[model samples]
Target: MLIPTRVRPSELDRLIAAVDPDLRAPLRGRVDLGGTPLSRATLAAARNSIITPRPLPAPPIAARRIAGVPGAPPVSLYVINQGEPGTRRPAILHIHGGGYVLMRADDTFPQLQTIARAHDCVIVTVDYRLAPETRFPGARDDNEAALRWLHREADSLGVDRSRIAVMGESAGGGHAAMLALAARDRGEVSLVAQILVYPMLDDRTGSRRMPRTGIGEIGWTSAQNRFGWGALLGVAAGSSVVPSGAVPARVPDLAGLPPTFIAVGSIDLFVDEDIDYAHRLIDAGVSTDLMVLDGAYHGFDGAVPDAPVTRRFVASRDAALRRAFTPGGWRRG
Candidate 1:
């Protein structure tokens, strides 16, 4: 298949054209001979580049202590409540994408605000522990604890515990999926749905050792995937084994899980695994919705928000989430 050379979104074309040719080269996927694997500092810088702060802000609805977590520090919950104080709305526990290494509550401000406003739901975006220092289960534990807290205080928060959903992007998406699995096994903290956007599901990097297909169109290369996974798992990039919770795909028995919305760009490295996981969800009797956007790459929605295709992709995701929040039988797409 021939990959079309990506052009800047029409709105940004002039701005992109005005940029120095050298800078534009990198944006166009041209690698710099001098550029090496980002140093810790450089990696941090690269991460920041992708997470542009939302200039406009919305105030959080309100916050209160739900359930006190044992041993760990108190989780400060940020909530955006919709409707009256007594009436309930669907709730979402959002986890931000950052390869499980970097990101903050503020980073997801725009998305949370939009969801809260559009869906009339309470959106809780957590500030979870990062990896390297804090590995697998650390973030998961924090997420679970937060979920438990939310369940306990659902009444006070005007949320229906049964209507709760878990949503996340990238590594956060992986965590959300794992949390759904963990909740199912526990048999108490039932989740209504899971929204996983371009999630990194499998830690078994070698599952497909064949040469990576569609390199340029995919955006994120094999080297970067290994680096992020290695950092999160606290092992060498190509290590022979990875621990459980390190990767969502590592968990077996995806049966009896809630419905799921799994999406990925056709060219994303995670495309194969996401597709496989979606099949597993369906095989296990879980309702699954999958979208494969053409001529797009990993993180395209955020990376190129101005592009028409990117907007269409984002709209599909938002619509999926909205349908999930609907009561009774979910509206099939």
Candidate 2:
């Protein structure tokens, strides 16, 4: 399922040399596991093949269901590290990454539980319906429903609604962006921040416009990206007429969104799109922080958590969330 590299040997040599020393072993010799792309025929198998979450002593996690947008089924939520009844804590509505087709709400507890404990905040991860099965607006509706539930039931959940933020890595990150946009437009909930890690943003990145030399050669191939977006979009990924609000990058205006933190590996397929989106957000007067990690590829942090760069990326994300949660640290724009 690996997409054969079209990169020239010299170009590849340069890319290999540029890889962080600790993250280079896979690309240097062994085949990269993340290199596989999914087709309609392989979707089920791809969904079954999952990276076993790195186990940690998880804090208590409660299973809850939130009422969905009218007519849709109830949205499932995993509430992690909920605070005491008399107390209130900042909250994050986390979205799990699976290219918008794979993964579930519970899949992220192993890592998110640690963040919840360390930051002393609650995290509500949503189990949004997958695409090609659910298609445009179905997943969006589920996410919106969960965010609304998180806000409307903040008191019961021991959450400080004003301190709420949305976060995700990869496809989840893209959904977080869309959720933030929806929040701004609907005026029902206010978000303090968005933390996106190497998010899958633009539909045009791998299709329509290919990445510049040596980029996107490591993990999360362009072909897989097309499948992911196409499944969620219900049309050719780069098609001109996507349903409005389906793709965050396709949104015309970025104004009035909350403070944003985006981190992407320089060599990731989403690097160009992520950086471009950050710039567009900034241009729209949104507060933004962007970091491009040199020589890293998509999912680098998850792939090599102990690597110095991965640790640093995780620290940066934690710091951003910490500041966003702090009173007087982030102002609604």
Candidate 3:
């Protein structure tokens, strides 16, 4: 049996009023996927429409490609530098969210430029391979490779090696978490912090076994969750054999990972998992900060940037990043 989740009355009304009439209907219904060619085309179109570019003016943005591991395709990186030339600055490896199957690094240039300017850091957004084609480990490999490339070229890029951090939203957040874990285990680049925004961290979240109420309605739905996770894992969600590195929530130990910040909406599909992950990170002796905004839905901050709630959310995240990158600012618990 499916339990209906209702959005907070005020939020539902606000969202409905803010969205265009053509999109309002789809927002009310589940994002259906059949894994068929036509359905894939429809999904691509919907994803493109939602992320229609609203370019923001900022410092120069450059596009560059880095060589991947032997036999792998080259990875693209969008470089945004806000600091002066020849001055070393903290760097952020930003991953854009698209439910693991849509969007690109280019789609996030406006937001990335804002973060880079605010923090005065170098921002590199990775254009990783998408799924249902590139599947598990493909995107992960690209993210990890980008991190390695950053470290390898830190001096030339004017990046402060010790102050590097990884940041992402939705599926990208999941990738950031996995990258942090891989970095710890591999004893490679040391990350100062990780910022996850309403991350899609658990495959079991959308399954019937872990149902919740008043979530997954306005932005990303449970059906979309299943599709995204399935595409990445190349298997049905809630499977028994999900690889540890593929799913951050599946990792048994969160010890030795960097200090983390997570923000989510009270009524977002990822609220519970985000909260639980923060709890577990705390339990594992990692410093963690979590922000939950009542009555807000997933992607609310980006969708309704002018709203007070969205402003607060962005402010809190910016403050956290500032603290984390400051010398001796973030301390491990």
Q: Rank the candidates by TM-score, best first.
A: 2, 3, 1
Sequence-dependent TM-score of model 2 = 0.93
Error of 2 at 139 (Å): 0.6
Candidate 2 contains a number of clashing pairs equal to 0
Model 3, range 1-333, lDDT digits (tens) per residue?
Answer: 011234544565655554434334434643331123213556766555554466576767888899876668899888888355556799999998988888888888888888888888998899999987898788988998899998878888888889899999999999999899999999989999999999989998877445465566657778778888988998888899886689898899999999999998777788899999999999999999899988777777666677777788899999889988898998965
Query: Candidates 2 and 3: which is better by TM-score?
Result: 2
How well does candidate 2 score on lDDT at residue 30?
43
Q: Alpha-carbon error at 237 in model 3, in Å?
A: 0.5
Query: What is the per-residue lDDT of model 2 for residues 1-333, given as tens digits with 9 covering 90 to 100?
Result: 112244545565676776788887656654333434578888888777675565366678999977899999999988998887757899999998888888887667788999999899999999999988999799989999999999988998899988999999899999999899999999999899999988888887778988787788776778878989999998988998988998899999999999999999888889999999999999999889899999888878766779999888988888889889998775555
Task: Give the per-residue Cα lDDT of candidate 3 at 250.
Answer: 83
Q: The CA-based lDDT of model 3 is what?
A: 0.80
Choose the strongest candidate by lDDT: 2
Q: After superposition on all CA atoms, what RMSD does each candidate show versus the true structure? A: 6.1, 2.5, 5.1
Global lDDT of each candidate: 0.68, 0.85, 0.80
Report the C-alpha lDDT of model 1 over 42-70, residue by residue, as the tens digit: 57666555545662456355554444347
For model 1, state the Cα shift of residue 264 in Å.
0.5
